[model samples]
Target chain A: AQSVSQHNHHVILSEAASLELGCNYSYGGTVNLFWYVQYPGQHLQLLLKYFSGDPLVKGIKGFEAEFIKSKFSFNLRKPSVQWSDTAEYFCAVIPLSGNTGKLIFGQGTTLQVKP
Target chain B: SQTIHQWPATLVQPVGSPLSLECTVEGTSNPNLYWYRQAAGRGLQLLFYSVGIGQISSEVPQNLSASRPQDRQFILSSKKLLLSDSGFYLCAWRSGTTGNTIYFGEGSWLTVV
Candidate 1:
């Protein structure tokens, strides 16, 4: 079955710490990838998306992700993380071979940034 | 800007009770609507999707059904709720002409006791 995987389940970091979250998918052909974040008591929001341009995509709040097609991986990264950055992150993708707008999302990664 | 509204924000239902979660989208037309469930360890499951009015596709077989009565209104219903049905249900939409980036609504928390 098609799936998206996020290896990190829960992560803890102190303020100003660098962060990296790994995401991988088992899909072939062209695909659209996305990163979404959900703060406490808030709805999910789009952080970034990769269609067909550069391998590295920049998003709001200084977060970025690099898509490696050979490995089927799209890893999210941040140079520094603040306590406010504590949230749940999800990786999602939609294969474009016979695409409809359906997205397959990972189990999600919970980040806890301490002050 | 496009916006999606899903409600009621939270609900508690007993087993065997009926369930109905409604969603509507504004600022866009003829969009693709979807229903997804977020469980603790199951990640996000695509329950259903619709491309047009009265056109619904079931992605998973469960105790749930969906309907798109109008162009921008999608509804998820279950005749009898089960304990396993308790989870976060999110309503999402994607532009038919714009891109594949799907936007989500404030999810509804369902707790079936």
Candidate 2:
């Protein structure tokens, strides 16, 4: 079974602060990783995804994630975050071998940016 | 551009009453559709998915069920609602056959009172 884990439940940061959210997954075989963001009152939007080639994947809104195969981690990072960047971020995993076509998500991290 | 829409932005239903939620996708064909439930402070829990019309897959065994009547339309229903069903329901779609990005709808808030 593929599962995702996010250690940080709530993150508080000031404007222009660097941000990094930890995400880890448990899958023995090939896997696909993704990060999704949800603003208050908005739907979950795809921030980025990693399938095959690049270990470091860049996403929308100046966010990027690196897939560390050995550590089984794909952490979301941003150089500087704005107040508007406050939202809930989720880490998801899809096992390549699973035929279910379903994604397993982490508990999620709530990012609160204070200006 | 592909867009997914879910109806009834918010709903308040009495316990044991019937429930129905609809989701439709536009600008895409034969999309892989999914139904998910989000409880407060919890991750999105996949409930059902469909590869095509009349095809459905259940992920979590619950009081909810899903159906794909059309290529772009997916419906979630429950014969009798339970208090545990109260949460945010989301519909998502993927463009292609395998290994695609999943996009979500605005989501529907259901409160089983």
Candidate 3:
């Protein structure tokens, strides 16, 4: 069984502030990584995905995540955040081999960006 | 383009009542379908998944059960509802091809009174 751990359960930041949310997964094999965001009262949307060939992946709304295999981490980051960026973010993963598209998701981090 | 639809966007059922939620996918074939429950302030917990028609897999033993009568149609049902079942139920689909990107439907809010 694979599991994801999100270190930051809740985060508060002012507009234009840099942001970083920690995510780590427990899987040894090759995996596909993803970050999804859910705005208040909105469905979950894909922010970005990492299949292969890139350790650093950039996503929508100026968000990015770096996948470090050695540390089993894929941390989401944004240089500058806006008030509209307030949402719940989820980190997910799927093993590359023998995967039936079952995605293991983290507990999620709530980001509150204040103006 | 592929899209997923789940019926009864909001449901309020009484304890010991029955539940039946339907989900279907369009614009794709032989895709994998899944059912997940999201409790307040928690991550999405996968309840069931299916690879093909009449093939279902259960992740956790709970009061819910899932079935796939058609390739793109997935159903979640419960014989008797429990208060613990109150949460947001989401239906998602993923292409069985190369990439592993899963797309979610507009979740159904279930409230057990």
User: Best candidate per lDDT, number?
Assistant: 3
DockQ of each: 0.65, 0.64, 0.74
Model 1 over residues B40-83: C-alpha lDDT tens digits? Answer: 86777889988789988898889999999999999999999999
Q: If chain B of candidate 2 is superposed on the true chain B, what is its TM-score? A: 0.96
Task: Indicate whether candidate 1 or candidate 3 has the larger lDDT.
Answer: 3
Query: Which lDDT value does model 2 have at B51?
Result: 77
User: If ranked by DockQ, best first, what sequence of candidates would result?
Assistant: 3, 1, 2
The list of candidate 1 runs beyond 4 A from truth reads: none
Backbone collision tally, model 2: 0
Candidate 2 collision pairs: none
- Displacement of residue B27 (Cα, Å) in model 1 is 1.3
Each candidate's fnat: 0.62, 0.65, 0.68
In candidate 3, which residue pairs clash?
none
Native-referenced DockQ of model 1: 0.65
Estimate, for each residue in A3-115, the C-alpha lDDT of model 3 and write its tens digit. Answer: 99999999999999999999999989888899999999999999999988879999988999999999999999999999999999999888766756667889999999999
Q: How accurate is candidate 1 locally (lDDT)?
A: 0.92
Provide the lDDT at A23 for model 3: 94
User: Which regions of candidate 2 are displaced past 4 Å?
Assistant: none
lDDT of 2 by residue, B19-44 (tens): 99999999999887889899997778
Q: Which residue window of length 10 is worst by lDDT in model 2 chain A?
A: A94-103
Q: Summarize candidate 3's per-residue lDDT along B53-113 as a digit string, tens digits.
A: 9989898999999999999999999999999999999999998875768999999999999
Model 3 regions lying over 4 Å from their true place: none
